[model samples]
Target chain A: MGVGTGNTVLKVDGVTKTFGGLRALDDLNLTIEEGTVHAIIGPNGAGKSTMLNVCIGQLKPDTGTVTFDGEVITGKQPFEINQAGVSRVFQTPAIFEDLSVLQNVMIPAIAHRDGKFKLNPFSILEKQDDIEGRAVEILERLRLTELMDKHAGSMSRGNKRRLELAMCLVQQPRLLLLDEPTAGMSRHDTNRTIDILKQIKEGGMTKVIIEHDMHVVFSVADRISVLARGHIIAEGTPDEIKGNPVVQEAYLGGSVE
Target chain B: MKKFFANQWLVMLVFSAVILTMPIWLSPIGAGYPDLLQKFMIFGIFAIGFNILFGLTGYLSFGHAAFLGVGSYAAVWSFKLLTMNVLPAIIFAIIVAGLFSVVIGYISLRRSGIYFSILTLAFAQMSYNLAYSVLTPVTNGETGLQLERADPRIIDSLFVEPTEGLPLTNFFSLSLSGYEGFYFCAAFLIIGFFISLRIFRSPFGLKLRAIKSNQTRMQYTGFSTKPYLLSAFVISGMYAGLAGGLMAATDPLAGAERMQWTASGEVVLMTILGGVGTLIGPLLGVGIIKYFENIFSAINENVLMAAYSGLPEGLQHFLVTVSSPFVGEGWHLTLGLMFMLVVIFLPGGIMEGFDRIKRLLMKPFSRNKDAVESAEEGH
Candidate 1:
């Protein structure tokens, strides 16, 4: 599939992040267009997670700039970045484990709808039909309506990941970041997750994902960027990445020649 | 819909009924019974407020007693300078405590988890020391603030009759004494309890739980966790202040020991023993601990020997001496043991222990229902 839709949502220019003597990200340059899935693949300690963190405001880069929707967000707080409509899901299912699934989803929904935290006891939460309706609709989309009343902690790993996605999706973010969304899943679960992600992309949400599994990267990614030692060595379509000799040697650890 | 009512008004009604009638039931036992019940309700309010911060947020502050002391001192000062009208004194006390919490919380929440708890503890110790020495004019130099009988009543102070030697109310010869004082304190406890209940059900309450679980996730979900945490802190502090104010209202005395770190620790024990995160658990905890302090402390060798006297002299002396430390002033030893057992065996508290018994009793009746639900949920 073709990228470069002329609607770049995230533009990272000459970004570098360093920790003490080590360079986690070195002059990383990338542009993720709107309504597409952009995947980054590399070995361990490749700074894939760091890049996502910087974009989502969890970490700040040492050098270079990040522009999202024509606004500089290089050093903003994570909550500020989130309020600007960028959201992320962690590798592990980070949810309020004790709260019910419905309550979990309602948290971000309440923050989004109310603009500030409302603590009035007299205000009936059950009367908020709009919020409830939207939450139910999102839960239905993820087939989690039946599990809404259940504690989020007890859900299986696959369902937990799905629930995390639902939480991120409920915010209706402009750009979504997924950090190893299918990291520990079986092959079948991985494929099923790819299908869910494909649906998310088809619904016109821009995505930046870091994946170690090349099968998942190739299955849904509109464009692929191969990173080695914290630098993007190649950026191309799936076929170009699959055939690139340098990428094969650097990433696949061998060459067919 | 019926289940919803159970979740709402049923709890309120039970709390109200217990607060209303507890002193009456206890007063017939002795002259000091109402006073003991009043103390229980006052501390119950304190723990319920404290649970919002510690139990809900999982921030174990070891200095919360400072707010209690602040409230008591503020209320006593109001009686000293302005008037003995409990309403304005309570309002002033709570506002001062809320403002104090804002400053402390802003600084303490900067470091989370263990750091936050330690920081709060340090602040509380600082307050205790300052009250004992540095802030002599304000805190009265450990002598504690006492209500002056001849103090001017500038603003509708509690009308007192010299004959009764206590505050009195007009019409029907009613007075704010004996069971009436206990009832007044009980009403405040009911209000504090319901307010806590509302806070537990609100969306803000859910976010507080989320912050407790994973604050980073909450931050990414567009919540500045600081504001929520700060608000919870202020609300909890105000609740403690209200309890302190009511304590002074009932007794008209304030002491520096009220703000001691051990006092703060006592409330923590109360919350954990009753069931941290359970709405009614803190009340149960405060009631149990207070009962132990009042009733168990009254149990002496004479009472014990009187009951088990015919069981030979050696056995009687052995039992009374062995249990002596747990009775009559060392009752906190028993409380400490109770807290340890509850924490170790039932980390969920007395509520969890009660729940275990309930599940055991219901096992045979709901076997198929639980089996079906557990299978579907997949653990």
Candidate 2:
């Protein structure tokens, strides 16, 4: 409820999505500010993913308008939405597994700068040094510089998730959407991820994260929205969300104290 | 350009040397004849193009031969109306086949995996039936579309009248028959191989491999995979078309059977047997299969007897009896056995077999080098 303070970069208004007999998303309204970490926490089947999918244009809403940077992105193609500077990391690690770590990051970097499609049949070799330099810089920042040549698929699940984030971040997206970014990670890896995300936050890009871990949500989120039965039930800062009776009853199960 | 040649020039040089000197080396193996050599180059191009789609993109097209047949028909029509020049025939075939691929690729690429393959198969079968029956006016049905002495040659009026002998397809004054025909096809094959090498290392090629790895991931990565796949399909189809046109130019006939599903399967077999994704693997597969088709099938009883004459009387008889099923009229049986062995022992195909052999050969040399280095360090 009016939690976002800065200029709104993404606005989802009256969005409803239904799959056959199931109403996955119902009259969902969300606003993500230009430079903040907004976390969406919900129970199973609470439509966190559905909202992310709608924003990324993976699933068209039954009735609503989703706008990004003043442009309606409700029915646009996934690539078109991505071209509009909205990037998503899936729940599971969705990366070009067969490609090396460098290539995995380079692909998005190329797509980011070159637009959707370029013939580029002859310039790969000439462009390799520059691309690889950029890729190496990203890998260094992620502390994955040593594994740059390793296949993305062969890496650990936690590292794959990191690589996926590196791929998304290399695009320098205006709006980043991450679905369970730290799912299945060890505590150490989760902390490392928190640190990386903290660095990313300092870079001043708006991020909408769907998270199940309360630790991650409380640690990183500037604003937290609690969802139950496909609607936002509570929205506030971390302290407010932790103390809110409605959020505790709906998601936290009881009072944290 | 310098970087392009850094990794590929050696391969290009070796390929050129082997293809250009085929007559000298193949004579000892009895595959030196022009017709067999020409078939080798034509099928080599076909398999190479097929690899661009099936091998790189991982979209197995079951009806690729339709493009080949379309190309042949286009070339034949060019011959009928235009001059006997092979240039126009080859060019027209490529254009027609490219157009045909665009239609088929647009429809079939809407689905993927097995469903995509089935769609292509259905389209190819439909084209085959139409060519055999309804489109007989163009294809000439079972007898096939053949060059006729009475047909108009509009481009060059030098030989308009009916002649007793058949006119050969030519490039200027030189005829496209005998060694010249083999050389012509070989030239195209080499050029195709170089183009394939470029594609394999290109940025577009990386996108195709990405699609093969994960289509969902590629789509979300801001790539419209449909256009990339369609481009690959059309490019591959044109490769098939170029091969078909070369076939017509060499022999002056386009048959409905060229569009048969078996012909499509043959190119797939060639690509898989040599190695699915390697640059020269498809061509190597083509050479092996064509060699068996020509030389293996040509080994009559007399040749078998001569081959075994140096052995003991009992052993010679036994050897000939045992090998008879694998040679001459039974070459297909040999091919089947070879395919099974390759599939079982070398799933990566003949290139994998070659790689294994190379590694085996290098093992001892590497060990010896390491030992020598250690001894020098001790001193």
Candidate 3:
């Protein structure tokens, strides 16, 4: 269940992250309000992932403030940021392949619910009924209840994406940062993922998704920001971004007459 | 209900049962089964600890035996100064090894993959060299450290003596007779097995595996993987120390050779050969290697000659010449060959082979059920 009203939950102000001489992200500034699906659209090497990394503390911006719920979390460790309610799903499904899908989802849920790294040998699964019940519900929402017993590695790419999304959802994260949620999916699977995202947003979760597919972005994005050369060129509602000259120039090439 | 056997705990329980029953079943055969079994269990403990570090974290440590050696030395020192109590000795060994692993893991983990392995190996070699030369009084140099009968143990406790001419301890208290020591070793192995099982199921263990699979991803998930990796390294090192402490308890000695690079290689071989990630594979690998070392190495030319009387003269002579290298001294060559074969053919070790056979047997029936389910779903 996504928490909070759609007021500004995360603020990234004038953030710049550079690797050696190459500017991965240049003077990026964006404010994500609570309870809305925000889409970051850009081409390859467009610094989309870098911006996500900076926001979540995987990478430090050379100069900028990333404030989540009013705390400066720019240089914090990934886990610390995660504990603060920012969860990320990787481009490639990063799941425990050998573990059952239930165990895979159970791990992060347990970590979040217990609020500490657990060391006791007692059955954590047994003790955590609410977490387990919620995880099962999330899996059901994704139509992954039947695959709960299957090894995560045994699943196809589409199913793995669902599993990753389920893991993030099960954490009940404040802001779920997804990198290409439908990266390697077929058309049917992409549409299904869009449907899932639509349902999640409808259910009141704040999501920031980076997608290469313009169709996927247009389908569920409440606000669209067009990023070009490490800076946001335009930010508005879907209709405005769709008609903006800069956005068209950035995506369609050359100056629009 | 029948499918419950697929649970990891059930497999571990079966393994523990087999390891525990070895002495009882094999002692009647009059072969030195108990002695071999004890050695296997000790090395098995060593490999299990090693598998946690190398298998779970994907950190290949080539210097792990340094911790084992450190444990042995720590136990021997405790034996020399404190009580002859095995508990204190083991505790000291574990603490020392854990500390050593921390220092090593810290430096080694800074680099990933092959560099990490090389760093560990270099550190281990340094440890071995220092123990052999610079640390003469503490390590006792080439002669290694040995128990003197005159060394005063504050709390006088009697331990079982070693078997005749074996020059090691018996069970915990009785003496180092083959039967008693074997059981003592078996008991510790079972304990180590359970501890490993706990570590595997713990949340900490889950994080360690996550680090192995995707360190960067784990970090992004808000877990600093360094501490988790280091903690696992120390825990595994403590297991190595326990194995070393048991060795000291049995033989009451510590040698630089125990921490040698070859010893490190042997444990890696054991873990890989048995099944790198599987719980029981390392023990099986240890048993396989030790079996060749203890039993095959004992077969000499005289033994071969004794058996030759039953064969034709030319065939007997040919057999002796061809088999000479594999028996008595060259058994390690055979072991190396076996390791290579296992690595190549059974990459998952005995566990993979076992799983393959099980899957093959279940496949025909299992596939039909899945097909039937889909057929029903279509309706």
Candidate 4:
């Protein structure tokens, strides 16, 4: 809304969620404009993951509704929400460990194309050239082509992150949600990941990233939102967020480096 | 891709040839009898269907025998009320078993892991008790349901006169008994094996494997896994049903004992002992267990001593005495020891053992790096 003229892809309204006596999300509202990389940065225990969970339908918001593409999607199943063109990458890579890396990427594309359910037990997987081509393309883009035949579980942490990202990208999702995509990765790997993130931005897929790494945040994020006590403390372009007094006091605890 | 289909066709031909020639090749080992060969084919179908569910999806269903039992009852009822034709009986059996599985799988699938197993087990036990007592009119209870000369065969009698003796289940005019019966079951097994292969290589099968690997990942990947699982459950149940129908087709009898938990356990043992996930492992497991059940259980001290007569008298007697207990009336002991060994050492069953032996033999010719790599490919 501040800079982009694109339509809103996701909107959270008065979302409140509680665990026991503690509120994880307290009347928080946010909007993600189309084709913009939005970063949500927070200190520990600031309900960053809880907000993502609610958006992806992993957890139900107790009070408010979630709107995606102008349709209310509250209380929908995770798969249904995903089928509606939202894909997620976990903090820890959630790739299918037993399956080959190619399959990990191919599965989401198949789901994306085939809808929620299809009973094609007799159709050969090898014959699905379109899906396979998409998977291979995504893998090559993420530099995962060499590891396509390897089991997903056997990949290094960085490679698995790339693999998980490949899995999401293969779906051509309208919106991508990544939770600490470089969490445990080396600095070299993190830099390569930021490059990969930049490469995919041209596809016009809106992204909401929950990151602790300031370098990743500033490099890929177009707009930054600082979260504290389950609500947005500040929202602006990265440079504005860096200079904002409230965001510095609440999240950074000092001026941005 | 064409090469894959070519390989599949080659596998089909070789399987058919082997199954068709079982009588010639197995005669030396004394398992060539029609009755025993028929059991092999029937149970081979059972395990092949089972692997589709347990092997691919990783749903350990302990109540499969209930489907088998239900199929038998349905087949016999079909023979009594509808027709004496084998096709109708088998179809009825499959349909009924499919319906039964939907109910059982629907309830049992609500929970997972050991709870899923316990739920299936409970449903099967309840089914057995009902068939044995309250549903005695349908199941025939203690005596079992058998073809009766007095019972109606509406479809068959409409076309031809009823014979005075008890009617035989037949395909058209061809009687399904003796060698013909074995051949009938073998045909079905071959067809079932081919279908199983198709399922193993298909996209649906990939989804099932994904579910088995990590269901949460599958869900987040935009798949509703319930329908896939239920379809697999019903499909496997129909397989057990077909096996049961074949049983009644070959020998015109339906017994409540077929529904017993022990019977379910036998199929599980057959699947695990052969290689749970391998295409042809369950058949080997079935052949071995069925061969032992028939051959080993028939061995007495006299039979043992006669076989060992070439040895010295004292040694022959000692061998007979020592082996007799594990043979006749104690064949389970031998099976138990084999199961134990397979579980402890060959955890992937007989197929894994074969894989290792094949690798070891090839290790000398190939580089160590390639040998290790190829070994990992199958895993």
Candidate 5:
């Protein structure tokens, strides 16, 4: 299978990261095209999440460069990287649980428009109807409109994950990163997440998803990369990745289909 | 403008009404005196500013009293060299305190949680020591910085005689003393409250709350949390400075003890005892603590006996004996007990208690509304 027809949006070349004696990411290279869903699948302790962290500026690699849309983002602050059009959804759903669901989504939208900092201490926040409208629109699409007034921490796990996604999507980032977005979700919730992701894919936003579920992997990924021992072992289309013996032995373990 | 007033008119009305009538109403409770009332408004401003940082951002600075002391010094110096007018003194105080906070906040914000608290505490203690010893030439040593009659008052000498009794802080010819002083403080208190209200309803305020809720999530959401925290810190320090300036404005004295760590701790107690994150909580805390300090400490055995004279002799004796430890010089004991009770039963402080009571009172009305809604749905 051939790579998707688009320019490279993100490039991770020769990235190596170490935590004391353990090597988390070792000379890893990845190229994700714009407007495509790329899945990085690996077994536990295989550095899939670590690579995602490196890409998102959460962890700096000992040696390598992370270029997003052609500008280097390595060693940039997380907020700076996010400002550069990269957004991430964590494995455990990092959300402002104390704030209402509406607030949770509105924050990123505000950040997207206002940049890193804007001190408008006198303007009433409620008067920003456009921002509120956009937040509500995203909530409606995520089927979270009914829960907009509810505190995000009180939501069920599935809803929390969806809210986290809504937060990222509200920013309308050019590149989205998901670290095991469907890690602990139920099958029904997993299917629902897949539907949402498919809708996002149709919007033409580039995505890098680290998922373990083969069903999720096969359903949404336009291209697949298998990782093992802190290195990318294989890269291809889903069908090619499924047939590749090295990917099967290293991560897939057997025929996934 | 109408819309803005429409939203805030009730708060403004109530605040003005309460502060304006405080002198009249407090007389009944033996707290109508200018000195005590001035303390209320000054500390009320301090607590309100402290609430902005501690309440919104959840970064507790234990060195806030340093700013307060700095403001007092700046204000006193202004009165000595510049003018006896309170305006320049207040402005100088706020700017000095703001600069001090920028330095301290920049260093303290590097570490959050308990470390931030300790760093602030260290800075305040250091300031206190420096003021008491090495900075004596500036601070006037342990006797504290006092306005001297011999000091040249360029502005005051041009207008009035310097040989006159202590030069009082004034707004033009209107002296900042007696009922006028109380009104002056009350006006500033209203301004402080209004500013805090605006902040509470602003996007900047929302960001501060977001920081309080989750700093890591805020950073990932593309917010540089440090600058936001620093802004809050400086704003809070300016508030403390304003309070200090007001204190010096009224009394015309600046003491090293004002910058002590305990003074910082007092503001913390005022904030927490009032409510950590509520708009009106810190002011209420200030009122309660100041009331206890001024009124309760004045309640001697004779006053207690007079209050309990109607009771049976044995019962009155027993009551006074049991209560003696919690009144007069033991007023701190009462404050401590109240703090413990509030912390234990109302973790959200006095505002939480008010909220609980308000909820309990509104329970029946809310249930009726729910019933009406359900009936409409059934129809």
Candidate 6:
């Protein structure tokens, strides 16, 4: 069911993206309501990551327009889209390897507050009290305050993934796009991440997640979209998608749980 | 412990002490000359600036010498046209070089990695060719730009009458020559080092490091890296320009050859040799290369022979012959060998070497502390 308040957050309309002869996204159309978690689950070649990339302006779509909060964001730069209150946690956990966890988290918050380019070349980092406070608060919320000074590169994969999430969350974006948040984590880590996702859900920031883990998918997603061959095969609640034979045959391997 | 080492004032104190006492300390190594020490300060400024761009952002610009050359030209022009007041010359040089870098950096930063390096290298070569050939009216071409008694010093003439001979570049009555010029240049070097230290600790500097660490993450994090990159480029250009300004202030000559790619490569070598992205490592590199350039290059066959005269007659002659190539005309060979060894053994440069030694020295103290802590735990 939709939000019923009729508040549409991200609208992907007639979006077609192609790689030579192969269509990665074949005129895919989808709508995400405000304050909801929409999970896109699909097979390997179903273009889930490609869809997220197009939405985030990392890849330009061929014959369609993707609008965010009614702003045409199809051709905008990634940083521009990001500045417009959209944050994405990369699939492979992109982070500033040379910096500490605190710096990794602080960068996004500074960018968000200071806009695309602020020439504060002389302003000391430690002197930015507000930014430091916000960054510290977010790291604390993510239970990463203990490891704040550890190098981002040296962090374990799960912790790095969490740090990436903290980076995204620090911006307090209107829309958060996560690509496979729990992809390579242990079940214990996966469960902890699910708790985090659920915790953020209470804050009412709309989330568009592309996930493969069925457990993570069902645990946090408010709604589900089953994508197959660059198109949505079915769209409904997690329970409804679990019972959908088309999704079961295509992605769920004829059974879920 | 890290905080104590990172204390900015303490670092600055040590830096000033070492730089100010260079004449006394470097005397033992036969490099205490004011001229040689001035070269150290000037190149130290250049290397520190180069480190800001290359060290922080990982943008290996091979055209920095163009900015230095531009600074030299601007400074000399100021001496000829405006004033020989080293203050105006330095300021004018910085402004000109900064604008020059803005143009070059804007275009070069459009590409990244080796392409950026190539673009910068090409721009420098273009600048050199222009100055050496086409821009003869301004640069004086191959003969180089020099001050003549006939030329007007408009600002200097306002306060004092023209002299029989070309007067020295001065601050009020004090001539900027010999140790005076070295101290003048050293003052700029200290100020430049302070600016660099601030940049390294500043959020802006951290952002540049982020660009080096992960460009994709920076872009996605909503940082438009071009402004940050261009600012670094321009700042380093100004620093190179400052070095050039000091050079002309002391000698009042500008040559197109200063923009050669070899000169640009020298700064890169200095930065890497000392330690890229370090506060004092670039200065250490400058000290090493300039020391070799001045001292090692002066050691002739006669000097080597005299030093080894205490040895056996045959062995003395043999030792002099063996060590001769690495000195005088072959000083560059020693520099090359040293660079190679550093690159292979100490990739982090002299700073890493210092760190290793410090750790080695601290081992005994740490072991005692560890033993004491373990005994207390057992109790």
Taking all chains together, the TM-score of candidate 6 against the true structure is 0.96
The TM-score of predicted model 2 comes to: 0.94
List candidate 1 segments past 4 Å from native. Answer: A1-5, A116-122, A253-257, B1-6, B24-32, B149-152, B156-174, B309-322, B371-379
TM-score, candidate 3, is 0.90
The global C-alpha lDDT for each of the candidates, from Candidate 1 onward, is 0.83, 0.89, 0.81, 0.91, 0.91, 0.92
lDDT: worst 10-residue window of model 4 chain B: B1-10
**Which digits, one per residue and each the tens of the lDDT, describe model 2 over residues B199-221?**
88877888888889888877778
Instruction: Report, for all candidates in order, the number of backbone clashes.
Output: 0, 0, 16, 0, 0, 0
TM-score of the second chain in each model? Answer: 0.89, 0.93, 0.88, 0.95, 0.96, 0.95
Q: Write the per-residue lDDT of candidate 5 for residues B90-117, one digit (tens) a residue.
A: 9999999999999999999999999999
Task: Select the stronger candidate by lDDT from 2 and 5.
Answer: 5
Q: Docking quality tier of candidate 3?
A: acceptable
Candidate 1 scores a C-alpha RMSD against the true structure in Å of 3.2
Could you say which candidate leads in TM-score? 5
Model 5 ranges with Cα > 4 A deviation: A1-5, A254-257, B1-6, B368-379
> Which residues of candidate 3, in runs, are more than 4 Å off?
A1-6, A121-132, A252-257, B1-17, B24-34, B157-173, B301-320
Residue range B211-300, candidate 1, lDDT tens digits:
898888888898888888888899999998898888887777788888888999899989999999888889889988888877888888
Candidate 1 CAPRI level: medium
The parts of candidate 4 lying over 4 Å away from their true place are A1-5, A254-257, B1-6, B364-379
Error of 5 at B370 (Å): 4.5
Candidate 2 CAPRI grade: medium
Considering the two chains of model 4, state its CAPRI-style docking category.
Answer: high
Chain B TM-score (model 5 vs. true structure): 0.96
DockQ for all models: 0.64, 0.59, 0.44, 0.83, 0.81, 0.81
Ranked by TM-score from best down, the candidates are: 5, 6, 4, 2, 1, 3
